[model samples]
Target: MTRPKREPRRPKTVWLDDDQQRAWRQLLALVMELPAALESDLQRTTGLTTFEYLVLANLSEADDRTLRMSELAARANSSLSRLSHVVRRLSDNGLVIKSVCADDGRVSVVELTKAGMRRVATAAPLHVAKVRELVVEPLTKAELIGLGRAAEAITDRIADSG
Candidate 1:
């Protein structure tokens, strides 16, 4: 069938104003730079990548030092595949053990070994010190609280969008 050609509609685009632009750029820089800086310090001091540290740390904080694979992935903000790969590495190092859940054989669970607990314990202070130096010490308490609120709001927005 013959039809008239029509222009495709474009979505409306809203431009950021100056203050929003500046704030966004600053946020972008922080997002890119802060993690790298923290990872560098953690690697130098603890011989652990940030992801590894996070996995260990998260496990350390869980009930009985254990969590199901999916739950761990969520807590660490990682995909199940990536978490499984890292868990494999940790298992190889005897830092964590993975097994089928007793209650649900379909589910896998991870538990921190004594060695893993020790590793996280040792790494924690160094990590906290670095965090304090880079993030906390520079800000007043009120500003830090406000920052926390802002971060929570941003994370909520992201979670809602997804």
Candidate 2:
């Protein structure tokens, strides 16, 4: 008689040690809380989510306030589907527009509208203030530099792995 197949055992979750746990929790809190705080400020002032702000910010810095959809998705660190949803919202809000790429008919390009520029300009100061209040104000100058370096290193590692 043929034997039935057995399922593979699940790997155990590795719980962090005390020191590691503390740092991990801190990082987790920062990742979750900071964005919520920033989003609150953005919503209160400009009626935009943090994601919307990122999209507008990316377009604002792009050549002629425009970028191909794929590039924008990479820069925003979001999936194409998520980017599409946000872009549709922004388009509906008159903050951005989408068009067929000139160089590649199959590709799409997203551009910031003048209204988006004005809105982002208005939101910039508020967003900066909130960031300063939550993250920067708590760190020393040296700590700030270290934090930036650490973030860059993490980003580089992710890019390398990708």
The alpha-carbon lDDT assigned to residue 31 of candidate 2 equals 85
Candidate 2, residues 15-120: lDDT per residue as tens digits? 8899999997988898898888888888998788999999999999999999999999999999999999999999998999999998999999999999999999
Lowest lDDT block of 10, candidate 1: 2-11
The positional error of residue 81 in candidate 2, measured at the CA in angstroms, is 0.7
State the C-alpha lDDT per candidate. Answer: 0.98, 0.93
Error of 2 at 132 (Å): 1.1
Clashing residue pairs, backbone N/CA/C < 3 A, model 1? none
- Write one digit per residue (lDDT tens) for candidate 1, span 9-98: 999999999999999999999999999999999999999999999999999999999999999999999999999999999999999999
- RMSD (Cα, Å) of model 1: 1.2
CA error at residue 66 for candidate 1, angstroms: 1.1
TM-score, every prediction: 0.95, 0.86
Candidate topping lDDT: 1
